[model samples]
Target: MEIVNSAKEIQEYLQNTRRELHENPEISNKESKTSEIILRELEKFGNFNIRKNVNGNGIIAELIGAKEGKTIALRADMDALQIEEETGVSFESKNKGVMHACGHDNHMTMVLGAAYLLSKRKDELSGKVRFIFQPAEELSPNGGAKGMIKEGALDGVDAIFSMHVWPDLPLGKVGIKEGPLMAASDHFTVTIKGKPSHAAKPNEGIDALVTGAQYVTAVQTIVSRN
Candidate 1:
C-alpha cells in the first residue's frame, strides 16, 4: 500500500502523474479521459466514496476521518486551454490545439497529492475531506463552479482549500491573501464594423483595426484606475 516512502519519493511519483496529465490535456467540458484516469488512481488510495459525472466531468470524493470535527474540502480544476504547446517537452500535450498551459494539470496533481497525504494521516484527522475535481474553471459566465455548487458540491463542507502554483512563490513557500484573493471574471466580445476596401485604398473605408486597438487600450485602463 506504500506508493511512496518519503517526501522525495512522493515528489517523483506525483511528477510522473502530472506529466501524464499534461501530455494529454483536455479542454473545458471535455475531460472524460482525464476524469477516467483520476477516478482510477483515486480508487487505489481506498477509504473513500467516489462519484463522477457531476454536472459535467466533475468528480466528487469523500474521505471520512477517523475522528469527528468538521468537514473540509479540497478542490482542483481539470480543464485545459485551447492553445498549442511549443515547449517541445517529451511529454508535450497529445491533444493538438489544446494544452495545460494554465497549469490545471498541476492543480489536479496537487489535490491528488493532498488526498494521498491525508489518507496516510487519516487516523489523526479530526474532520472529513472532500476531493473535488472540477471542470471548466476557465469558462466564464458558465463555469463548472456554478454547476458543481448547484449539484451540492458544498452541501456540508465547513471550509475549502485550493491553490494555484505561482512561480514567484518558491517551492515549499505559500502565499496568502486577505479580503479578495480573486477578481471578478467576465468575458465579452466586440465586433468593430468597417467598410470593406482594397488594401491600398486610402480614405475609402473606416479603419476598424485602429478603432479596436483604441478600444482595447481604453478598457485596459479600467483595471488600473479602479
Candidate 2:
C-alpha cells in the first residue's frame, strides 16, 4: 500500500532517467556510459551493497532484509541495437546508428524503480533482493549473462525474474503467465560463393543474390509448410 504510493511519487524520476538513457544508447558489451549512469543513480539510494563492473559493464546492487529468508534476483539488460532511430522524440538517441529498439532502456529503468521502492521498505522485507544490470543482452549466443554468471552474479541467489515491454498491452497494464513467457533465440550464418563476370557476359557467373533469396524463401516454409 505505502510502497505503491512511493512508486507513484517517483514517476517523474523514473521518466527522467529513462529519457536520459534513451538519448545516449550504447551497444552490447559497450555500455560503459550506461553503466556509469545507472551506478550514479543507484548511489543515491544509500543502502545497497553495490558491485560495479561485474563481468564487464554490469552492476549488481544487493539489498538485504533485517531477517533471514530467501534471496530473489531482478535482472535488466543494458544493451542497444545497431539500428538508426527515427522516433523524432524529444529525447531521441544521440548515438547515430544505435538505438534502444528493443526497449532495454525501459527494462533498466523498471528495475531501477523496483530497487528504489524496495529499498525504502527494506526493513519490512523477509529476504534479500539483488538488482542485476546486465550488459550485452542483445548479443545472443554469446550474451553478457554467461560472463556475469561465470563471475558469480547468481552466487547465493535463490531465484531470478525479469520483464520486457509489450506494446500490445494498454497503458498502465502488464501481462503475465504461469509458465515461460518468451521463446529462446538462436543465430546462424550462411555464406554463398559465386563468381563475378562482366555484365555483358551470358550466364558465365552464378548469381549469389538470387541464390540467397531462394534459400531464404525455402527456409521460411520450414514451419509453415512442413
Candidate 3:
C-alpha cells in the first residue's frame, strides 16, 4: 500500500481536531456533542450517507464508488478517559475529571483525514468505504463496538481496519501486524460482605479489609501461576 505524504496538511488538521476534542471531552455513551461535531465534519465531504443514533451515539458514514468491488470499513472510537487532565495545553479539557490521554482524539482525526483523502480520489476507488465513529469504547462490561455489531454494523462489510496511536512508535513510522496485535483486557471487581463492628473491639466482626487484601493476593498468585 502506498503511504499518503501530506504530513504537513494532515498534521495541521489532526492538531485542530485533537485540540477541539480535548477541550470538549465526553465520556463513554454520552458523546452527543462529540457525535454532532463528527457528523458535521463528515457532512462537509458531501457524498456520504450518514446514519446517526447507532448503538448510542455511534455514527456510520458510507461512501460508495462507481465500480463494483468489495466493501471496507474503518473504525475510530470517540470516547475519553475518566482521568483528570494534567496537560497544560491551551485547549485542555473543559470537562472536569475527564481527558483524552489514550489518543482517541487522534484516532478520529486519522480516519477523518483518510476519508478526506479518499473523497478526493473517489473516482479511482473501486469499492465502498464505511467510516464508523464509535462511542463507549472505554466503557467496561459492554462497548460501542459490540453494540454496533449487534445493530448490524458489520452486516455487509468485507474487511475492517482500525488503528490506535502509539506514543512509543517513532513520529514518521507506522506499525502493522497480521494477527492479534494486542492482548484482551478484562476488569474485575470483588466485593466482600462482612459484619461491621467498632474499631475498639478486636476480633468482634469479620474484617472485610483484611479479607479483601487476601483476595487480591490470591488473585495475583492465580494469574502468576497460570
Candidate 4:
C-alpha cells in the first residue's frame, strides 16, 4: 500500500469536514442533508461517478484508475447518536438530542480526505477505489452496511478497508492488526410474559420482573466466563 505524504493537509481537511458534520448531526437512515454535503464535496474533486440513494441515503462514488487492476472499497458510516451534545465546543451540534459522540463524523471526514487525495492521483493508482458513505450504521435490527451489501455495494470489490478514530490512541498514530482485530457484536432480546398481580398479593401470579432479573444475570455470566 502506498502512503500519502500530505498528512498535515489531510488532517486539516478532515477536521473541517468533521466539524461540519458534527454541527449538522443526523440520525440513522435520515442522512439526506449529510449525503448532499458529501455529494457536493465529491463533485468538486472531478472524475468520480456519484450514485445517490443506493440504500436509503447511502452514497457510492467510484474512481476508476487508468490501468486495470483490483477494485478496493473504503467504507465510512455517517450517522449520529441520539444523545445530546455535551462537549462545549464552538461547533457543537445544532440538532437537539443528537451527537456524533462515536467518532463517525471523523470516520466520514477521513474517508472523504482519502477520496480527495486519491482522486487527485488517479492516474498513478493501479486499481479502482469505491468510496462508500453509508447511513444508519447506529440503527438496530439491520444496519446501513447490510442494506448496501444487499444492493450490491461490494460487487466486484477485492478488499474492504475501514477505520475508526481512536481518541485513546495518540494523534497521527494508527493501530493495525492481522486477524481478530475487533470482536463481533451480537445482540439478543428476550421478553417474558407473565400475569400482573397486585402489590399486596403474595402468590397470585408469576413475577416477570424477578424472572427478567435472573435471566439478565445468567446471560451476563455466559460472556464473562467465555
For residues 1-226, what per-residue lDDT tens digits would candidate 4 score against the true structure?
3455665657776778789989998999899889988998999889998899989999999999989899999999999999998889999999999999998888888888888888888999898999999999888657888989999899999999999888789977999988878555657878899887787994887899998999989988997899
My TM-score estimates for the predictions, one after another, are 0.86, 0.90, 0.88, 0.90
lDDT of 2 by residue, 1-226 (tens): 8778888999999999999999989999899999999998999987899999998899999999988999999999999999999999999999999999999999999999999888888889998999999999988888999999998899999999999998989998978899778767898999999889788994998889999999999999998986
TM-score for candidate 1, residues paired by index? 0.86
lDDT of each: 0.89, 0.93, 0.86, 0.89
lDDT of 1 by residue, 1-226 (tens): 5544544568987999999999889888999999988998899888888889998999999888889899999999999999999999999999999999888999999989888888878798898999999998888878899999999999999999899888878888999988778666877789999787778995798888888999999989997999
Q: What's the residue-level lDDT of 135 in candidate 1?
A: 93
Task: Name the regions of candidate 2 deviating beyond 4 angstroms.
Answer: 191-210
lDDT of 4: 0.89
Residues 1-226, model 3: lDDT tens digits: 3445754556787788778877888999989889988888888877888889999899998888878899999999999999999879899899999898888888988788878878877888888999999999988767788989998888799999999889899997889977799556777777799888888985798998889999888877986798
Highest-lDDT candidate:
2
Off by over 4 Å in 3: 1-3, 187-206, 224-226
Stretches > 4 Å off in candidate 4:
1-3, 195-201
Indicate the residue-level lDDT of 69 in model 3. 94
Supply the TM-score for candidate 3: 0.88
